[model samples]
Structures are given as structure tokens and as C-alpha cells.
Target: MTLQKVNLQEKFNLFQEQWRPKIVGELNGQHVKLAKLQGPFVWHHHENEDELFLVVKGRLCMELQGQEPIWLEPGEFLVVPRGVEHRPVADEEVHLLLFEPAGTLNTGNVQGERTVENLERI
Candidate 1:
């Protein structure tokens, strides 16, 4: 594969859908994804895979079960461990970069209308 640098803003400009994640890069069984998020997402957890969320713009409120919400801002990131139930909420449009195992489902263990089984590569 040809190696090239990815511009976050340029890649983000290619899509405008919320909750849907687009693949940007990959390495060592992990995928670097970009997504635009607004509103609340389903509460779910990966049975085996861990997830990393990095805010590129706006704010993210990560809600953990039976605990207070953790807020993330631009340039900030949070790692949600495996099997830990969590939900991501955004009051406004938020740009995010996610690092997780390849083929990891956006909806985790929950298979619902919001689940994205086929992720688009941008």
C-alpha cells in the first residue's frame, strides 16, 4: 500500500452523516476512523474489543453505566475498556477520531437500526 498523510479536516469534509464512521487508516489490526456525531448514541459495549475516542472538534460526553459522564474536548481522547457499557452523547456537531480493532462494530454488541455493519472508507 502507498503511504500518505491524511488531513483530518479534508477527510471530514467528505461526509456529513452522524454516527457513521469512515475508515481513514489502518495498522497492526487496528483501524483509524473518523466520524461526525450529534445527539445520543445507543448504550453498548464490545465483548472483546476496546475503543478509543479522540475529539477533533466540539465536545463529547461519554456516559458510563452507573457512573458520572466523562466529557472530552478537542485534542482529548478517552479509552473505553472492553465489556464496559458506555454511550456517547453530543449536544452539537462533534468531529471524532476512533482507534479500534479492525471490523469492530460501531454499535458494539447491539444490533439495531443505528448499527453500521458496513463502514465506508473515506
Candidate 2:
């Protein structure tokens, strides 16, 4: 098997659309995804999957139900456990790296226009 290093900036430059997650790597039934985020996202929760959000650029405010917002800066990360309703809000364009189980939906329990059923591999 051949192994290659993935460049995060190069992969991020391949897409400009916000809220769309592009797969960059996979391991142990999990996917490493990259996305550009702005504005607020839907409030949702995963039934059985935990999500890890790593801020690559800008800032991210993770809003949990009935809780104070958790701020994440560049090089910081947060893991939202399964069954916890949460939302991500960005005041400006933020580059993010997400680690989640394979086939995990971006919108989780709530599905609507923002749901990305098929993710593109970069």
C-alpha cells in the first residue's frame, strides 16, 4: 500500500462553498473532513455518533443547548458527544477540520436544505 501526506491548505483551496464538507482522509471507519463555515448552522444532534470539530482558521462558537457557547480558536478542537444538541456559529469565514464516523450526516437529526448526503473527496 502506498501512503501519502495530505496538505490541508491545498485541499481547502479546492472548494469555496460554505457548509459543504469534503473528505480528505479516512481511518478506522472515521473520516477527516474539511469545510468552510460561516453564519449559524442548524441545531441538531447525532443519535450514536460523536463529532470532533477542529478550527483551522478564524473562530468557532459551539452553542450547546442551555449552555454557554464554547469558543474555539485556531489549533483548538472540541468534541460534541452523541445525543447532545448543538449548533456551530461563525461570525466570519472559518476553516474547519471535522472528524466523525463514516456516513455521519452533517445535519444529524434535523434534515433540510443544509443536509449534505453525499460528500466529495478532495
Candidate 3:
């Protein structure tokens, strides 16, 4: 198969819905994705892996239980420790680079509106 060079815009274009992640690439044993998020999400955590979120545009906030929420701006990134419960709240539409395993659900253990069982590609 011929190799394809997909850019950020191409990946961004693939995102058509909110809180859904589209896999873009893979590094080592992890999958790299682009997700568009807005509004508040349920508190959850990855039981077996650390998840990293890097804001590509707009503000993204991570609220930890009983702790100050962490705000990520464009060019900023945060790695939430594995098994640490956290909720994500976005004031406006935000684009992000999500690094996690291939089967990782964006909302983790929460089975709600935001969970995409079959993660799409953007």
C-alpha cells in the first residue's frame, strides 16, 4: 500500500461531531488522535494507561476531584495520571491531540453520550 501523508487540517476536517475522537497516527504502542470537545463531560479515568491531551485550539479544562482544574491553552499539554479521576470541561469548541491506546474510549469507563465504541478516523 502506498503511504499517505495526512496533515493536521486533513485530520481536523475529519472531525464532524463533538466529543468524538478520530485516529490520525500511531506512535510506539499508542494511537494519536484529534478530538473536538465542548461542554462538560462526566468524571472518569483510564484504569491502565496514562492519557495525554494537548490543546490545538481554544481552552480545555481538566477538573480533578477536590482539586483545582487544569486549563490548557493552544500549545499547552497535560498528562493525566493513570487511574486519576478527572472531568473535562470546555467553554467553547476545542480541538485537541489525544494520545492513548487504540481501543481507549474518550470518556474512559463512563458509558454515556460521549463514548464512541468504534473510534473513527478524521
Model 1, 1-122: lDDT tens per residue? 67899999999999998999999999999999999999999999999999999999999999999999999999999999999999999999999999999999999999998999888998
State TM-scores per candidate: 0.98, 0.99, 0.91
True-vs-predicted CA distance for residue 55, candidate 1, Å: 0.1
For candidate 2, write residues 13-113 as lDDT tens digits: 99999999999999999999999999999999999999999999999999999899999999999999999999999999999999999999999999899
Q: Which scores greater on TM-score, model 1 or model 2? A: 2
Candidate 3 lDDT over residue span 85-121, tens digit each: 9998999999989898778877777888777898766
Query: Pairs clashing in candidate 1?
Result: none
Give the poorly placed runs of model 2, Cα more than 4 Å off. Answer: none
Alpha-carbon error at 83 in model 3, in Å? 0.8
Best by lDDT: 2
- Worst lDDT window (10 residues) for model 1? 1-10
Please give the clash total of every predicted structure, in order.
0, 0, 0
